[model samples]
Target: MACIDTLLAAFAEVAVDPDAQLEKHLAAGKRVVGVGPYHVPEELVHAAGAVPFGVWGCVGSSVEAKKYFPPFYCSLCQMTLEMGLTGTLDKLSGMMITGLCDTLRAFSQNWKAGMGSKVPMIYVTNAQNRFIEAGRRYTVEAYAEVKRRVEECCDALVTDEALARSIKLYNEWRATMREFVALAGQHPAEVSVSARSSVINAGYYMDKAEHMSMVQELNAALAAAPVSLSGYKPIVLSGIYEDIPAITAILEENGFAIVADDMAKESRAFSRQVPETGDPLEALADGWCALRADTELFDPRKEHIEQVVELAKDNAAAGVVILLAKFCDPEEFEAPLVKKALGKAGIPAVTIEVDQSTESYEQARTQLETFADLLG
Candidate 1:
């Protein structure tokens, strides 16, 4: 097994420099498709002989994107557009955008208008009512269209064999990630807050198989190492994204160890596995339909509230920290209910408003410090 520090450094390097990773793949003559936020069919891209590069917004100000979006729009969508407009994503062979929420729905239109033909845009619409027979059929057909578009864009065939292989690889990757999260929680001192985020975030910019191998090694290293007795305050995090180094730094300074999370960028992306048997497209659709407790998905029962409470209790977390992304309507709408549920369950929780452009984290530090005190 590789040294834990060495593995962590590798992940941190890749996590912070996804552009370099994209360039590296481009230099290798590999077709790269940019996948936007939420549940996207990355397996199709892999089967189509291309890299599925994540296009989650970066930490930066949105200048050019302002013309396309209002000030009230979420920074995540805005910065993503800014990257495309600034030619930062010019090298991408194609871009796949999902209409999971209102902001993302508008983002797709803006990306089409702004990027034009410089990069191909494949728009995907997911059915919110995903558990019914109609919804399942819709998912399969929608994903089939995505497969067709991906094949056309990559100039390669998404044959059943290739798709099946990709599905198996992704399922294995997901299972490995779930293992890593549990291991990381067991040894938080070895995996610092920022380090834990880096390891998971790195997967967004890397080949699933490659990232999984490194994580498997890291998991082994962590398992062999002595358990953490640091007595840090364990907490569960819920958010659209929580990979920001500054935010993690605050949690680390406040002596918080994230044992589990509902972050879309982390566990939410890998909490469920794709079915390995039967039709690959239907399997992918079933995987998406299986997703629960996410703000993007339709949950009329407000099950996410109880889910957060259960996660905190299950992990023995003293509290829950919500990294509320600014101007994200779905998360904003769901935050109150989650807080209420946690309160009823006797789980201490705090919400920190997060934005991509904000350089200052002093407010977050203060809030987290208070939260830490409360937990104590």
Candidate 2:
């Protein structure tokens, strides 16, 4: 329990400090690359020898960013641009954003104009048609350009060997995280909902190998701990983001435990590891194709819904919560279909809105409490 507590504390420290890694990299005179949500080829950033700091945006409303887009845009984009304009991202040598959705597509341009040569912005379009050969080729080329941009920013090259090593390291970390999530599920009493977020979110702010060592030890600790059969409702969470403060606590307050999640910021990012063989970038491209269909990408077969269903059934979840990021159009469109599928299957479910600067969880607590009672 002591070791587990230490690990959780360390991870929580990193997760709570938004600019810790960036400051460290700056102090060391190392180039830091800022990466926005959805899809970013972080391997390319690592291969270029720059730190890849996740930019989920600041947790407050941004009056400056309002100038670029309508008020309807999600807070993630709005606040990230706010940070960029407000000089919060001045330490980063470059930033990467994907055109995965309409808001992100527009954000990339707004960022370039706002920064105006202060920080270079790399633009990438994730191949939605990734199920096909042409799509794979297009993604590879897009990654190649990302590689070039990062290399230029760092004044270094993403060599094939370095890229291959980065891929291997990332896969190793992903495997360790996979082990942690599985163990966390079996010992929900110890993990707690916030502890789960700590263990997962902390990795984004540290070097992969460092994060791996910490998590590997925590996984071992969890494996050695006693299991509990508590009267908490277990559920699978599917959504664009899980960085909202107090979300896990709100669920725990309602006698619920998050056993698993399909959150883009969490498990979805590492659902499949890149294959170690062949070209590293190519392997990464293949790995993208293998990812479970989610709101960001096109799922011609609608396997994403089935993936959600399978997660709940396999985890024996009491229900599934589709935590939609507010004003996110793709996730908004998927809500009804998600509800319909789970409804037909006789699965308990709820859709909750989450934002970074959530001042209150009262409404969410009520919804989850109602769901828990219905399941009971």
Candidate 3:
């Protein structure tokens, strides 16, 4: 129990304070590359002998970023730009920006204009038609370009051997994370809602291999411990991101436990692993193309809605909660469809608007309390 609490605390600390992690790596003379949302090929950065630091934007107001974006911009992009503009991320050696959504595409341009001089930006454009052969080829080429840029930024050669090693390491990390997620679900009494989120969020800041070791230990501990008997209501959480303590606290206060999630920042990020027995770059491309049920990605058949339904059913969830990021058009467009699909499947769901700037969660607390009663 002591070990479990210590590990959880460590993860939560790193999750909430990414700057400390960045400075720790920098102090060790490591080159850190900031990676933006969705996917941006972190294997290449690892292969180039640099750390791939996730830049998901912190929980804060975006005052400086207002000059670049309108009031309707998503807080993820706004806060990320705010950090860069305020020189909070200036210590990063480079930044990798993926244009997965309209807001992110615009953010790429705004970041280059605002902070290009302080930290170099690598704009990565993924092929949306990724199921086709031509699309796979295009993705490979794009990743190759990313590799080249990463090499240039780190002043090192990204050899195929190194890339293959990095791919293997990342796959191992993903598998370990999946195991940890399952363990957390099975023992919600031991792993609180916020603690489960922090464990996953910490992966964004720490090195993959290092994070995996800690998670593996935690997983073993959870597996050995007795199953939780707490009267927590298990549910599936679908969102772009939901690491906000205020929001998660409300869920826990309302007796909710996130047993499964379609959140892009948590389960979605590790749902697919890079195939290890192929050309390293091609494997990376294939992995990225294979990612499913994500709002930022293209889904012509609206399969993402069914995917959410299936996720909830598979986990035996009492309901589904959609943590809708305010001003995020992709999630906004899909929320109704997901809710409709859940309704068709006879699953209860609630959508709550969330943003980084909001300090008050009273409305969310009330909504969730009502949802909890409905679930009961």
Candidate 4:
């Protein structure tokens, strides 16, 4: 209980600071932890009283990261390492990475061999198989192992009550963030798309109460706005780590409304928290399994894909934009499949490749303008 209290207190400090977001909080004594893409098991980290930040590099710097990581390594890994080498990730005490793809597996090894400042590295398995029995077992084992490792890092043990409370708090936070996401889709300019994106992305790393406050502020701002059509080209963005709010801002300025998007970190991570339980670890394990099951490549429900199609259809979006991180295998792997499906649905789509250092917004603008023209 004391440990949970301490964890939440630390998170609140990071969340509400007028000047200190995660970058500022990292300077403090708290241990900064990193979680890779795919089944990060963040509930366990938050429960263990550690800060878990997602390590997708910010917009624009691929050319520099390329010097260190080979071309085979995905852009996401390169971006992460770029921050690590340049001392941006100095605040991190450790990293929790998964073997989500071949690039990630190799990058894990490089993290140990290459970086002079090696934060503690915790490697978790990324079950490639979807929701078969074997896959479920692999996920369960990974969740348990991650929970144990988080315990070791904090010198803390998991209590049933503490774990349950952490899960509940995080779930509430997720729901509220989701609400804010829907609001952003409804009114991008009114919400400050960048601030909403940062708050939700950083929420995964910071405390719950602080995140809740940020959401409340966003919700209040939305509620107070006047009602009207944005009078912009309706666009639905799809992909990962799309930090180029400049494009969205430009589109909005040109009377384009970013009605719906799947590119932002906040859009991807805002699911209900694992439910509270008498046995928190088991509950957490269940939550991880549930999320994986929902997002599995072959999910029979086809919910994720369906959601994308529905969002496009519902918004009557003028066109769909896909922003892929160069060398992001997961997005690369998923894009063609998504494009084909959406094409069948008759939604016009264009795909762009950008990295954390997105230096090509002008080129992208030309493409977006053309896409808008085609839709007309």
Top lDDT model: 1
Off by over 4 Å in 3: none
For residues 110-191, write the lDDT of model 1, one tens digit per residue. 9999999898898888999987989989989999999888988899999999999999999899999999988898788899
Cα error, residue 30 of model 2, in Å, equals 2.0
Positional deviation of 308 in candidate 3, in angstroms? Answer: 0.8
Measured against the true structure, the TM-scores of the candidates, in listed sequence, are 0.98, 0.96, 0.97, 0.82
Count of clashes, each model: 0, 0, 0, 14
| lDDT of the candidates, in the order given | 0.90, 0.84, 0.89, 0.65
Q: What does candidate 2's lDDT look like per residue over 1-376, in tens digits?
A: 3488788988999888857766877787778888888567788898888888888886777789989878878899999999989888888888989998888988899998888878899888778888889989999888888888888888899999999999899889888988888789878788878888877888887888988999998888988988653777888889987767667777767767777788888888777778899988899899887775777888777888888888899988889988988888888888889889998888889999987655787898888778888877
Better of 1 and 2 by lDDT: 1
Compared to the true structure, candidate 2 yields what TM-score? 0.96
Arranged by lDDT, best first = 1, 3, 2, 4
Query: Once all C-alphas are superposed, what RMSD does model 3 give against the true structure?
Result: 1.3
Per-residue lDDT tens digits for candidate 4, residues 36-136, read 66557666666666676777655546555676677665667777777667666666667787776677788777776656446666778746654566876
State in Å the error of residue 39, model 1.
Answer: 0.4
**Candidate 1 runs further than 4 Å off:** none
Candidate rank order under TM-score? 1, 3, 2, 4
Residue pairs with backbone overlap in model 1: none
Judged by TM-score relative to the true structure, which candidate is superior, 2 or 3?
3
